[model samples]
Target: MTFSDDLIKLKQNRSAQEPLPSGIAPYTCSAFFKSREYGMKPKARRWDHLLSKESHNLKPSPLKTASRASGQKKLISLGTARPAPEYFPWESLSLRCLQDTVTEQAQPAPTVSMASVKLEQPYDLGVAMNYGFSGGSPQALRFVTEHIEIIHKPPYDDWECSLTCGTTSAIEIAFRIFCNPGDTILTENYPYSGAMTCAHAQSLHILGIEMDDLGLHPDDLDHKLRTWDYTKGPKPSVLYMVPTGQNPTSTTQNLIRRKQIYAIAERHDLYILEDDPYYFLQLGKSKQALASAQLDRTDANEEFFKCLSPSYLSLDVSGRVLRMDTTSKILAPGLRCGWVTGSSQVIQKLVSYYEIGVLCPSGPSQVMLYKLLDETWGHDGLFNWLRSLSLQYRCRRDNLLESCERFLPSDFCEWNIPAEGMFLWIKVNISGYRQTHTASHGDGNVARYLAVEDRIYQKAHDNGVLVSKGSWFIADVQTLKGVNFRLTFAAAPVGELDEALQRFARALETEVR
Candidate 1:
C-alpha cells in the first residue's frame, strides 16, 4: 500500500478502540515520528513582529474549558448578550423544582438553566438537541472562534463564526448573503467543481480568473474586474478561491500575491472567500527536509511551518476576507462539520439564512470531533498530526509524480512538481486545438478536441482508470485551447496509481495522435 493508502486507513480507523485486527498500531512510524519535531520556526530579528515569520500567535491557545464556562455564564446570563429564549413551561418548572430542592438544603444548587444544564450533561445527541439555535451549540462557537483567532490571528475581535457542513455550505451561505441570482462568482481559471455546481444551482454566473504559480494573478484579476461589463450583469462582489493547495492545480498563494489580490479586491469591492480546506496539509515539509540537511526533525518542522505562505486572513486588515476551515480535510469529510469567520455584518446574514435551512452541523459529528481535536489532542498534538499527515501525502505525491512522467507520452503531456494538495495538473499539447478545432468544431478534418478528449476519457474509464478531464474545470471553454487532466497523487494506493497510469497511457496511445 502507498503512504496515501496507509494514511486513509489510519484516519478512518482512528476511532477504533482496540488495536487493528492486524495487531499493528495505526500509523506505525507515521511521518510524525520520522519527520521533524513540533513547533513553529524562529523569525528573523525584527522590531515590528507583524512582518516577521514567527507565528503571530506565538503562544498556544489556552484551554477554554474553565475560562469559557465562566464566560458562557455571563453571555447567557440575564442582562448579558441576548439571553437564550425562555425555557418551555414544563422544562422551567422541573428546573425550578431542582433549584428549590437545592435552596432547601441551603446549598448554591448548580444554576439549572436549560442552556447551561445542556453543556453540563454528558456529551449526548439528545442533550445537544435540547438547546442551541439551528446555528450550533454555544460551546462549538466558543471553541472554533478561539481556534480561528489562534491560527489566522485575525486582528479584529468583532469577527464572528458560524458552524456549517463544510466549505461547500460556507460558500453557498456567502452566496446567499452577498449575492443574488445572476450575480457572478469569480474564482481561479480552474475552480473547484463543487462550488461551481452550487453556483449553477442558484442560477448564478461564474467568472473565472487566470492564475499563476503563486495563485490568482493580480494583473488578470485587476483586468477582469476593471474591464467587466456591469451592463451585462451585476459586478462580481465575491472572489472565491482555494488559495492554499488549491484543488486540481495544487497551488499555494505566496504572501506577496495574497496581499496583491487583497489590494485588488479593495479597489474592486470584492469579498474574498478563502476556501482553504488544505491549509494544515503543508506539503512544503518535503522541500524543508531536503533544504535542512543539517537540521533535526523538529527543526525541519519549524522551518517548514515558518516558511508556509501567510493566509489571506493574515493580510486582510479590513475584515474583507471570510475564511472557512474544515475538519473534513484534517479529520473526516463525513463529519460534515466546519466553521466560518467573517465580519459581524456578513456573519449575521449568514447565520440568519443558515437557521432556515440546514440549521447547524450534525450533533454526533460535533461531539466526536470535539473529543478528538480538543479533549484528546489539544493544540500541539493537533499540529503534530497535521505535520505527519503532510509527510504521508508527500510520499504519495512523489510516487505518482514520478509515475506520470514515466508512463505518459513525453512528447504531448507536461507535468509540474506540485507542492501540496491531492491532484497533479497535467497539460496536454495537441495539434489544431487552437486554430482549426476550436474555431470550427464540426469539420471532419479539424480535430474535435472534446471528441478526442471524450475518447481518451472513455478509454481510460473502460480500462479501469478514473481520471478528471481538465476541461470540466475551465470557466471559458472557448478560450481554453489545450487538453489536460487532473490526476490524484495523494489518494488511492501507490500500486493502483501505477496500474492506473499504465491504463491511462494505453488509452492515450490508442486514442490520441
Candidate 2:
C-alpha cells in the first residue's frame, strides 16, 4: 500500500480507539496522529519578537478558557451557560455529494447523512450546534490536519493547524497578530484587493515588490528589504503572497522560485503569509490530459499528490510561513470554511483572537464539512475530487484562451496563458493611445493611462462584459503603470465566455482606437 493508504489506516485505527462518548471529542492537534518516526527534524524557532503589540496584549477569553473543562470524561457539572444538545432544533443533517471519479460521463452522487445518534455517526447535530472551542471541533480539525500532513508536511516538528471562518477572516487575524499600526508590509506588485484593504484599515503601509511571469521577484524583494528606510517607520517584517495561481496575475511560482524567495525571507527574518486559495486549482500544462493519465493509473492518488506544486509550508523549516487555505476555491464558498497551518505558537495566538471574535467557525459549517470531508470523502476521495475539479477548470480556461485568440485584436491586447487559477490577466497596449490622446490632452502620463483604463472598463461594461480593472488590485495605486484587466473563466458558460470576449474585443477596439 502507498503512504496515503497508511495515513487513512492510521486515522481509522485512531477513530476506532477514541469514539465520542457524548457527541463531543476532545480538542486535538495534528500531533495527535502525526508520525514522529520521520528522521529528527528541528523544532521551529521562537517568533515572540515578531508579534504585534496588539497580539502581545491579547488575553484569552475566560468563558472560552473554562469551556475546555467540559471535555473531561465524566465531568458533568458545568459552570458555564452551556446549552443542552436536546434543545438544538436540528435533529439530523444530510448531503448529496458527487462520487469521487474523473470519468467524462456524469455519475450518480451519493447521499451522506449524520444523525444525533452517536453510534450512527461520530459527528452530528449534537456537537455541531453547540458553542465549541475556538480551534474547531476535533473531527473536522483532524481531517484537515491529516490533509495538511499528507500534502504539505511542514519540515518543522511544532507545526499545527486550526480551522478559520475563511481565508479572508484568516488574513484579518494574521494581519492583526503580526502587524502594528504604521508598520510596513511587503506584497506582490498586484495582490488581492481585499487584503490590501484589510491592511490599510489597520493603518499599515504596503510596499509592492516587482514581479515577473513566474510571480514575485526574489531580487526585488531582497533589494527592497535591504534598502528599507527607517524614516518610514520599521522595516517590513511580513511578506504576503498568493504563491500559486496568484490573484490578478495568475502566476504560479516554480519550486526554484519559491526556494529563492524563502531564502530571501530567511535572510531578512521575514514571516511569509501564504494566502493560497488557488493552490488546489493548480492546472499544469495540459491538465485535462494529465488528469486522464493519472486516473488510468492504479496509484492515481499518489500520482496526483506528486503532480502538485510544493507549498511554502513544505519549505518552512523555521516555521516563518503562515499558510492560509480555503474551501472557497475547491468547495463551495458559501461553506465559509478554511484553515491555517503554522507553528504552534502562532496558531495559539490566532485561536485567542477567534475566542474573542467569531468564537469559532459556524458550527453547522464545521459539522457539514466533517461529514463531507471526514465521513463521506476521505483523503484519497478528496484527491480524486480535486483532480476532477482541476480538469473542469482547465477546460474553462481553455475556452477563455481560445476566445481571446479568436476575438481580441492582437496589436492592442496580449495575455499569458494562465497555468492555474480562475483569472486571465490581459495587458492592453495603450502606447498608441498614450501618444495620440495623452500628448494632446496635456494630462500627466499616469492620469491619461488611468483615464484610458476607465474608458475601456466603461466600454466593456456597456457592452455587457464585466471585467476587473488591474489598477484596483495594485498595492500602491500611485504607482499604477499599466492598462490591464482581469477576466475570470470560473463563471459563465462555455458559450457565454466566447460572447463575452467578443464584446470585450469590440470595447477594446472602440476605446483604444
> Which residue pairs collide, candidate 1?
36-297, 36-298, 37-297, 37-298
Deviating ranges (above 4 Å) for candidate 2: 1-25, 70-72, 102-105, 117-122, 286-296, 434-443
Every candidate's lDDT: 0.63, 0.84
lDDT of 1 by residue, 456-487 (tens): 78889999989999879877666566677888
Question: For residues 1-513, what per-residue lDDT tens digits would candidate 2 score against the true structure?
Answer: 465666766666566555433445345566665664433788888998999999999988776665564545566645667677777777888777767764578575778777875325555677777777788788888788878877887888888899999999999999999999999899999999989989999999899999999999999999999998899999899999999899999999999999999999999999999999988775667534454555546676676677789899999989999999999998889989999999989999999999899888988898778777777877777888887788778888988989999999999899888888899999998888745444345346677778888888999999999999999999887788889999999989877998999999999998896
Q: Best-fitting candidate, measured by lDDT?
A: 2
Of candidate 2, the 10-residue stretch with the lowest lDDT total is 17-26
Off by over 4 Å in 1: 1-125, 129-131, 285-301, 432-447
Decoy 1 TM-score against native: 0.73
Q: What's model 1's lDDT at 287?
A: 37
**Once model 2 is optimally superposed onto the true structure by TM-score, how far is the C-alpha of residue 70 displaced, in angstroms?**
6.9
Candidate 1 at residue 80, lDDT? 20
